[model samples]
Target: MEIYSSLGIQAGISIFSHIFFIGITFYALQAFRLDQLFKKGRTIQIQLIYILLSIAIGSSVSNFILDISNWSKQLPYIFT
Candidate 1:
């Protein structure tokens, strides 16, 4: 029962973090003159790859932190 609860909490936190990271990324990209760079085919491809990689990294980091937090909460003594 406790394990299930911990898993649920960790999932929720990871989801929230992913959404937040995506939102920030979207806004940052929009604020920049990315469209101008995208006018060139090569530049556009590079930019797309960069954005995808950034999002992937962000999600991975968020999931890792959420898992660590969940583990710490489940075993507070070890984390402390």
Candidate 2:
């Protein structure tokens, strides 16, 4: 009962974190000149790259934050 509720909460937090970070990542990525790096007329490919990069970077950041949060919560176990 309680465990299931906790799991649901955790899942919700994970989803929110991923989405929030992905949006932030996408916004930050706007500063990059990635379009210049690719060949001209690859608009679709460039768009895909942007989406993939956003997910990659965002998910990585989200995981790192979650790991830190979990670790902090476990710190009490380090002692009696």
Candidate 3:
């Protein structure tokens, strides 16, 4: 139960952080009106691709950052 609780907290934090970044990216894209510049049919396609690529890249990046931060947390124990 304790382990599950701990894991849940970590997972929740990771998910929220990822969502925050994804939301911000979409917000910025909207602000720049990037989708409006494309042809009508292609606009939807481009937006889909953009969103998928962003999630793929963003997840990898956020995982890397989380790993690094957790690595620091474990550093002291390794030396001991």
Question: Which model, 2 or 3, shows the larger lDDT?
Answer: 2
Query: Mind giving the per-residue lDDT tens digits that candidate 3 earns over 1-79?
Result: 9999999999999998788777766665555655666877796688786788668767766777889989999999987
TM-scores for the candidates: 0.56, 0.97, 0.72
Report lDDT (CA) for all predictions.
0.71, 0.98, 0.78
| The candidate that achieves the highest TM-score relative to the unseen native structure | 2
Better of 1 and 2 by TM-score: 2
Q: List, residue by residue over 1-80, the lDDT tens digit for candidate 1.
A: 99999789867877899878766665565656655656566776867855885687677767777678768778968756
TM-score of 3: 0.72
What are the runs in model 1 whose C-alpha is more than 4 Å off? 40-54, 60-80
lDDT per residue (tens digit) for residues 1-80 in model 2: 99999999999999999999999999999999999999999999999999999999999999999999999999999996
RMSD after Cα superposition, model 3: 2.6
Best by lDDT: 2
lDDT for predicted candidate 1 compared with the true structure: 0.71
Candidate 1 clash figure, as a count: 0
